[model samples]
Target: MIIESYSFGRMKVDGIGFDSDLIIFPEKIVSSWWRVQGHYLQVRDLGEVLDYQPEVLVIGTGYSGCMDVADEVKKELEAAGIKYYIEKSSRAVEIFNKIDSKKKVGAFHLTC
Candidate 1:
């Protein structure tokens, strides 16, 4: 589903522009306890929103980029048979768009 617009606490996301600290693709109702910047938060939030655990989770860490994917989260995903790709914001967007369009995968992207 196309996300027309959304506002979450200090974050604001719209199709045309973003006024948020982050943007979650394929926007949908989210659980309140899911924290955006918290450690291991992306996987938790995406799991809540998508309703189904994914085979892969791609994380776009902020501008400077972060290579460390939390070991615990990685273990959980791996145990659940989920692969992960962690990269900078720009590359994450490209990868997400490609997989989303081709395989109809579900993705949650957060960017600054």
Candidate 2:
């Protein structure tokens, strides 16, 4: 899928706009995604992406990077051998645009 645009609290992917947290998979977009702790991220919040077995997982930690990705979550991803990245939304968008993995996923927190 192609990300057409991204701005505070919103993003456009493959011609569809999303105003909430979302998971972008190679073949589909999961909208209205919510985390267990609102602004905190955990492995349990990413069950769908994990089950997809992506080659890479890029995390967008919100517009101003307010969301916190837990250490234990990182450890779990590492254990699963999934290459992952955590960055502020803007930077993460750049990284996501550059990746060419056949099986890649992105979990994006649209706003802070």
Candidate 3:
């Protein structure tokens, strides 16, 4: 990954961005407040990084983890047969780390 920028609590990987405080795994992120800044989960983009079919996609919605993903995107993931997991950032990070060592995973996260 081309990490283009990094600061006290944030980083920009290639064009994908994230916050350091958030925990991330192969498939999910525990917190993703940074997504509001015009960065988000793009399946095709992620697919390029994974280089294979990912079993799941996880999103960490920040604080309460309340964020509504676009319906079309959700449907696309379903069509691709990728599972979706949405949760608070902390828990999402934990799950990501656990599964990352075993298989294909992608994570995006941002912190409060």
**Candidate achieving the largest TM-score:** 2
Number of residue pairs clashing in candidate 1, backbone atoms closer than 3 angstroms, sequence gap of 3 or more or interchain: 0
Model 2 bad stretches (over 4 Å): none
Off by over 4 Å in 3: 1-51, 64-67
Comparing 1 with 2 on lDDT, the higher-scoring candidate is 2
Cα displacement (Å) at residue 27, model 1? 6.4
lDDT head-to-head 1 vs 3, winner: 3
Q: Each candidate: what lDDT? A: 0.46, 0.92, 0.50
- The candidate with the higher lDDT, 2 or 3, is 2
Per-residue lDDT tens digits for candidate 1, residues 8-49, read: 222232334443334343444232332456534444545542
Model 1 gets an lDDT of 0.46
- Per-residue CA lDDT of model 2 for 1-112, tens digit only, reads 7678889999999899999999999888999999999999988999998888888999999999999999998998999899999999999998998999889899999998
Best-to-worst TM-score order: 2, 1, 3
RMSD of each: 5.6, 0.7, 7.5
- Worst 10-residue stretch by lDDT in candidate 3? 30-39
Q: Candidate 3: what lDDT?
A: 0.50
